[model samples]
Target chain A: MNNIILKVENISKQYRLGLVGTGTISHDLNRWWHRVRGKEDPFLKVGAVNDRSAATKENYVWALRDINFEVQQGEVLGIIGKNGAGKSTLLKILSKVTSPTTGEIKTKGRIASLLEVGTGFHPELTGKENIYLNGAILGMTKAEIKQKEQEIVEFSGCQMYIDTPVKRYSSGMRVRLAFAVAAFLEPDILVVDEVLAVGDAEFQKKAIGKMKDISRGDGRTVLFVSHDMGAIQSLCDRLIVLKNGYVDFSGDIPGGINHYLKISELGSSMNYANVATDFGIEKVTFLDKDRQEVNSVMVGQKLVIRVDYKNFDKRNLSLSIGFLDNFSNFKFACRSDVLDVTYKDNIGVAYMTIDKWPLSEGSYHYNLAVHESSVMLQNIKEAGSFRVEKGDFYGTGKLPGKRGSFYIEYQWE
Target chain B: MNTKHKDEWLYTISSKRKLIDFNFKEIWRYKDLLFLFVKRDIVTVYKQTVLGPLWYLIQPLFTSVIFTLVFNNLGNIGTGGVPPFLFNLAGITAWNYFKECLTKTSSTFTTNKGIFGKVYFPRVVMPLSITISNLLKFGIQLGIFLGFYCFYFFQGTEANMNQHMLLFPVYVLMMALLGLGLGMIISALTTKYRDLSILVGFAVQLLMYLSAVPYPISEAREKFPSKVALIVEYNPLTQITEGFRYMFLDTGTFTWFGFFYTLIISIALFLIGLVIFNRTEKSFIDTV
Candidate 1:
């Protein structure tokens, strides 16, 4: 018997951005006519991988372009991509929620998708009734559902309100019930998309555990998408990175995570106009000890984030430096110059330092700003962003001893 | 033993067909879901209404009474010897079923888009389930007609009802096919235009009058000789409804040619509707 359960070839999905009606009708009609005639859709011929970062003239752009991959039975594949990278579009095509503008997806057995928590849940129906309804919608038969019904209820921990309408349940309870039904579906292929992000911490751990059990114990193929790098790294045996609707990288999880982090940090085009107005920060510059502009710096090396500006109108200004990780979750923030610094004249330069930059060996972003006495300065939000290079924060190729953005070295007796 | 069986099962599952194209066996396996939807529609529709299921019977019965008065008594339309009440009731009942099926099926995508967008069931199942549940409602109304007929028969007041009434199932099926076909075409189109949805309610009413639900074709034939009556006679729904009266009431006409003509037309239209509907379901979400 063949072990390959799913084959996705050159699959791409394209979506028109504005009001769906009237605007795209002619384009849709032409596309449909071409499809019926068995010709390559004309729209796919335009656009390149580099076209993603900059907006282009073509009305139609591929959301997922020429994506070719296959998943054998029992493979747990993780998909990670920043916003607008077409990760959700890829899952939507594979799960058959929507058809691709071009390319083909071939899969054996039923495919169940948990695209969003409580996606098919009817608020008016009881939890139990919704289970049956949603289970059926996911392509499970009544007998198959009955066999796993008890296990689902127990797993969700919503047995007390199983007969209660889902509308009355709390948000956490709703996601639990939804996840329970989705994960227990036992389809030949399961496609999950950021569904666990809504639940509580305890439920999230349990959900990941159940996903592992599904892939390992049942030998079902799984495709998962999430922004949580740690979860993706732990759960997926293999990973696929989507950057602007194209498969940028597809391989082992560690390498995919590294590539994803780098792209996110480098992708944004910094705006200088918005940066100068905030935090008494008239100007922000990256410099070495020699006060020269430096484009790149090694990890753990002496670095400076210089904010030069005015103490206008005799107000107290506090300068703060914060570090953010690839997922945009803040790793650490600290404020210096807490004491009242009064300057009758308008200009001065304030420097902040990271002696050891304990950040894990990955690209990190630092935001430098001055708050008006504790409140962040105006325009500070727009003006601050700088990259930190990989240092020997945890030795070479080793995970930060702790599962967090940066390792904070502390002493014990 | 468990390991061996599990291994075999896993192998078989992976080896199953990919790119499933509307398998009937898979649909049959999800029969419970179909029943639940059928039950949900039946129960929820009348949940807060005062008259409840009585609305079903009262609607056609009252409409039939109105027709009998305006078309038969006032306008002097003939019933071919059957009482005007029974004559109008038969046509109105059958026509109502077809119209309801068409209306419900046409609005299938718009009404269930919320549900369909969230889940993956055979898209056809929803419209098919709606057609069947409506047939159940039709069955109840048909029962009311039978009661009226038995009352008139035992009382010896009504004229002869034709024995061809035994061919009732054929007419019922024809009505279903016509409704499904027309409904599917409208449903597929509505996903794109949506203007059709707003006009459908009134259109069904206007179509009722056009189908000769209130007056018999025999009477129309006497008044307007060849051309006008010929058009009404050939109306696909005309043959089915008039065929019902022809079978049960022993009245004006029953032509094998008319029945065959309608059966052929309805079947062809239904096949076309299915093809268009199948293609539309694939990409309707993008537009909708």
Candidate 2:
């Protein structure tokens, strides 16, 4: 069994919402007074859990609440969450860039966090100089950096401009150099937060490959935070999902991903209050052939996507609907003009039905657009979402399990 | 939290605060980073400027000229028997180094917030690097002053060169510590209050006059009333400038007791500043 190298016990971070200067002094005094009397901090009990969607009169909010986990040596741990879910706050605490309002962390060996690329790179410094500066900031010694200088430059692919100032490099070239320098950091544990989101696709692929080498080949612990579910699923052995500053789920990749998808789908129900626009989609719903609202349908079920819009202009409008997989990749699309369907009413309902839907067992999103010829009047991305469950399309007792996104009929001799 | 396996663990982070928890060993381990930061400060300042390093020479030279005219010619302040140009040059040379270190280090939190927010290392490394980089500039400016001192010496003018000159390094170290200590305190405070950021420049400017940079301490004692002269004599910088001129120019007073007094003060201030700095560094990112 692998050794547990990092342990986080009930870490929590609270932040005041307003100007910190004048407001913090009183809190500091309160803390000091409490310490003098040998009592617990008075303000720690007052803050509410972090939820950006809700309104509150309190000034304090908990950015992270009781986050606890352990990472074994050579284990790759992935953290996933929606925006404002306290993912960055947790990483910052583990990195020691900021202190938690409460709790402790115990780790074996050094931990290097690549929260952002080009963190300390000076624009006026040459590429060679920035490599040294950024490497040192990441906890590499001068001798260590000198030993790996050639490898870093070669990996960055900026060998020709090694002596040129970083200000002269393009944004892509800078990110490439930054990632290369960070990739060479040989720590016992590496904490990375969305730094792989920069650079071109090729460089991102190379960076992900390097991270794999860092954990598997070098046998080091890695804590990674990213919203790219595909990357997380492929890279992480275990996953942690955060919601409203709390750990929603922590387990295997597939289970955690499914739980996150279900939660987000439940949160984004067809509420017209959030989809108010001048001439756009007022609400979107997924229904079966019987016109009953549904969120999960069988693979061969007749799925109907209904879009209600208030078309302020009474002109004939064409509606285009697209189906996308869980990764937001377009799987298929249908346009009203292709089927000779038009809407002439000021307030209209457009529905597209796919008889015997061919999608496999997975979650998906649908996009809606209302247009007149080439001019787009309204467009809503990922307007509605649904899940396709396992079902037999061939009338046999067989159903597709963990296969690809869609299915097709075939006959073999 | 158990100490039984504490030896096995390599790193531990907690909410425990200590008053004088200065990690000297950790700082020694990161000496390479300190040197790299010092190098960056020196190399990048004049990278694209046309004057390059000559700007270092021009600033003090012009400031000394202005001091010579305004204080010597207009204000009738005497430089004992030494040439007024050399007197003002030496004062500006030593003062410039301290002022630069203080101003730069005082803004450490604000200027390096981006880097500090992203990574973790010894926060003290930033201010320590500023002191060292400014020390290099001080060395250059001291050479220029020596050049002028030699000319006046060879011309049979009263240029003091004595055995007291052996203590020059100690004097420079004291000045560096004083600047670094005050700068750290200001840097830590500004992360919360931010009013100190605006007051530091104006305060340093006013402090220069009280430090006897443009005139000798004796001149102020004789010209001003006793109560006013007592305030000038109390400033720690007065002893430094007076002792510095006493050694090189042989014109100002020098006392061993006063030198030790300033040394003790510098060390105390440095320790206190380090305590405050360590306390602030853990959470300054949030407030800043």
Candidate 3:
């Protein structure tokens, strides 16, 4: 077994809710006085847990609380959570960009975090100069950057404009250059926070390939935080799921991913409100052909989406529904005009059914929109979501698992 | 993968804020970052400007002429027999270094919020770079002052260059330390109380008058009341500037007691600044 490279014990961060200047001084003084008298901080006990959904009377909230974990050398750990889950806070603390409010982290080697790409790049500086500056900011020595300078430029594919100022480069080129500098950083422990969310599809593939090489070839530990479940499932050896500033799950990749998906389904299901009160969508729900409200369906089962609307006005209104993969990439879309459906009712439900769904096993979200002859009335992205389980589609007792987003009919010669 | 061998260092970060945890070795290890930051500050400042580094010479030159017009011609402030232009240039050159360092470093957290929010480095590297970069500007301004000094000296004016001039480096170091110290203190405090940032510019300008930059302390002592004279005399920067004039131009009140007092005060302020800066750097990102 590889040795444990990092240990985080009971790390918690408490932040004041509002303007900290006026009230903070008194708290600072009170804490100082109590420390002088050898007493525990009286305010430390008064903070509420970081539950963004709930209203609280206390002025202080813990963004992270009692977070404990350990990482073995060469292990890729994925942290997954919904928004306000404190994942970024934990990464910030681990990166030493900010200190924890309580608890300790023990580490053995250097940690380089790409909390953001192009973090310290100056727009006026040339790409070459920014490579050096950003590399140094990411904890690479000057000599080391010089050694990798050629490789970084080549990898970024911006060698033609290495001496040109970054401000002159396209946004895609900038992200590529920034990612190249960070990818060359050879720290023992690497912490990446959604850096792969940048660049085009080709560059993202290249970036993920590079990360995999870094983790596998050098036997370095990697802490990756991303909302892209497909990438997380493929890249991580283990996972930690955070919810409301607490560790909701920590185990193997599938277990943690399952827990996270379950929580997300629960969270998103509640958001099925009438988002736009004026000529708006009232609710969206997912069900099976049996008309039962199903949280998920087998890949080949009949999947139905029911979108309820209000204030329709019966004015030649058309509705469109789109299916998106976990990364929010649209897989397919269907419009009511194509189906030759017209709604005359002011408030009613429109159901879009897909017989023998062609999607592979993964989580997907539905986006709904209503338009009156092209003038958009209501558009709700990610109105509801459902999971697709593995099922045989080709009448062979086999299914495509984590291969791609969909299934296509084929004939074997 | 040797289980029997333990790592050389174990870093533990807790909520407990230590009073003084300045890691000099870590700063040393990141010295390359410090150098690059200094280079960035110097190179980027004059990139698109027409006059470029020439602005360095122009700033002190114009300020000296203005001082000659207002402080010398109008206010009748004596320069102790040294030409008013030369005297004003000398004081401005020295004060400019300290002022630049103080104001730039004072906004470290606010100005570098983008960088500090993303990555981890020795936070002191930023202020250290400002001090170094400002020192370069100070050097250029000093060179101009020397050019003017040579013209006055060749004209056979009563310009005195004494053996004490060898202590110029010491004076520069003292000014840098004092500026860095005060800058760090203000920067740390300004992270939470943003109003202090607004006060820094005005306060530094007022401090310049108090430090006798445009007027010598001896003249201020003769002109002002006794209480005001005592305040000007006790100002640490006043002694530093006065000693600088005594060394370079060889005419000003140069007392061993004043030198020692300024030395003690600058060192004390530096230590206090370090303590507070160290404490603030850990979590200032949250507030800033």
Candidate 4:
């Protein structure tokens, strides 16, 4: 009976879009009247899906619709999504911070939500006082907090400033103390919403260890939401991807992550006709050494790039391709002049070949340029991107974790 | 709807809830949170201030003095043949408590939208905590009133203290309930229509005049028209203020009918406020 600790049944939340003003009350009035008459809520028939980017003539959107899931005892489930994907909304509903518009969620035990660290923290309260207050806000009784006060203080490393008001603690120390209190919560189910995104790296490690302990050791269930793929890969046994407020994918960690990777990848081929110069690139295609087009390739594999151009004005211009990381920061560039290649013709093609692509396991975007004698002709940034999966870079099948966006070939004696 | 899992599940969260489910057990479970919130309010209010707790006494004292100067001396309003200063002091002391509970609790949702959005607890804990927290301030203000009460008693004036003083605690309870109840109603309404919150500050101030805080009910009856006098008589806060003046200075009218009428109304408003408050708390975060 206790095997399934939580069951979410057909949970959905409909939200009225735009400003909540006069029209909102009229809709509320209409819904109430319908409810009194034993009719379904008219707004429940909203057709628009929740897409924050688009404009809508309709007044309503379904933030979450018929979301169904269950958590077994001691299982860690990760909810991965982009911004406004209703991750926070689902967590809020599960923790009873808000109620779902339709259906229900049945849970067997206590649910503690860490939507944010230090909920109800008063800056004027001393660190020790805030610990008790924060713990109580998280549904802990006074006696329970008192018993764990010493351990919480030690974990926070804020023993010296226990009596000092939290207003004086540095932002980092405050997060430490808040997270420390959170770590001690003995709830049967914990709902975390990107709370691990804060705090230092070492503290985050400790917090993650504590979360693992809470779920694995104590047999409590956890529903975690985070954008960090590594944390999801390490902590969650199961994963669900939410896109536009719907469950787009759900499965084992690696499978869900791969599905997420594919969904998040952008176009691999792009045309440059509109941005063409006198001697400009017409198109760019990412390919393997076999000349087969691909959007993703293994690490340390040969990557061949083909650039088709139209040298209408017949200018002596050299082609260039620059690889950029996620932030659009240039890591390295490939210039045609490296091989003393320059072109001045009616139309032509260019290529950049790397025997071993050195970028680490991550998605990389690239830019294109055509220049003549230090005078830039056409520079198109963020032209296209491709993904690189992990591979056995060395002969040994061992790989160090991601330190940066590079894997250069080197040797030592 | 199924019977097998219904009883086994410890909690069920859904869109529809009982209209009058106060969930007192949940509030009781969060008693520690309630206590800490009360402590935080009381302690943080006076922090880094030079006067600190003295400001509690000074607030009513200064208000009483101002009322004495403006309403009694300048406007020539008599205080039942007793010293106008003490009479005004008594009314202001009780008025401050009611106003404090009302103004602070009326904005519970707006003031606490941050914590409420991020966490789940009985939302009533906030207003209940405010009501309890303001008690400490009211207690101190009562102490100051009593200090003056003894000073005048020894002076051997016509301010006769009576057995009506036995109802003092009852009067304090009614004030808190009325303030807290009205505040809950307004705050709940404000979660959707925020214009209601903007009206609370000035509304409470204007209400003090109608509640007979600066002057006694007897004066309002004698000076104003019968309809306006009826309005003052029917105001619930008028009963508590008159009860306090009667207890401390023996200078205001207090009838059993008016007293219980206000009491019944306070209890009714409180229950109604609780229902609205409970309904709003369940889903206010969406609108707020």
Q: After superposition, which runs of candidate 2 have C-alpha atoms over 4 Å from their true positions?
A: A265-267, A270-295, A299-322, A332-358, A367-383, A390-401, A408-413, B1-7
**What TM-score would you give candidate 3 relative to the actual structure?**
0.85
lDDT of 2 by residue, A139-177 (tens): 899999999999999999999999999999998899899
The DockQ-based CAPRI class assigned to model 3 is medium
Residue A262 accuracy (lDDT) in model 3: 69
> Which residue pairs come into collision in candidate 4?
none
TM-score of 1: 0.84
Q: Return the top candidate by DockQ.
A: 3
Q: Please report the TM-score between candidate 4 and the true structure.
A: 0.86
DockQ for all models, in order?
Answer: 0.32, 0.50, 0.53, 0.51
**Per-residue lDDT tens digits of candidate 1, residues A237-339?**
9999988888999999867886786677553422232343433656666667676777655555666666667755556556676667656677787577544
Interface RMSD of each: 6.0, 3.1, 1.8, 3.2
- How high is the CA lDDT of each candidate model? 0.75, 0.86, 0.87, 0.86
- Residue B24, model 1, lDDT: 76
- TM-score per model over all chains: 0.84, 0.89, 0.85, 0.86
lDDT of 1 by residue, B143-251 (tens): 8988898888888865566678678887888898899988998999999888888888888887776576777777667776688778877888888888888777877
Which pairs clash in the backbone of model 2? none
Please provide, for model 3 over A34-119, each residue's C-alpha lDDT reduced to its tens digit, 9 standing for 90 to 100.
98999998888989889888999998999999999999889999999989999999999999989997898888878889887887
- Evaluated at residue B253, the lDDT of candidate 1 is 76
Q: Per-residue lDDT for B1-288 in model 3, tens only? A: 334555533577677776788889888888889888899999899998999999999888999999999999999999889999999999988999999989999999999999899899989999989999888899898898889999998999988889888778888888988999999999999998899999999999999999989989889889989998899999999998889888889878898899888888888988998889888989999999
Q: What residue runs in model 1 are displaced by over 4 Å at the alpha carbon?
A: A1-4, A15-57, A117-124, A164-174, A197-202, A228-234, A251-275, A282-300, A304-319, A324-347, A350-355, A369-413, B1-22, B159-162
Residue-by-residue lDDT tens digits, candidate 4, B171-239:
889989988999999999999998888888888889999999888887898999999999999999998
Sort all candidates by TM-score, best to worst.
2, 4, 3, 1
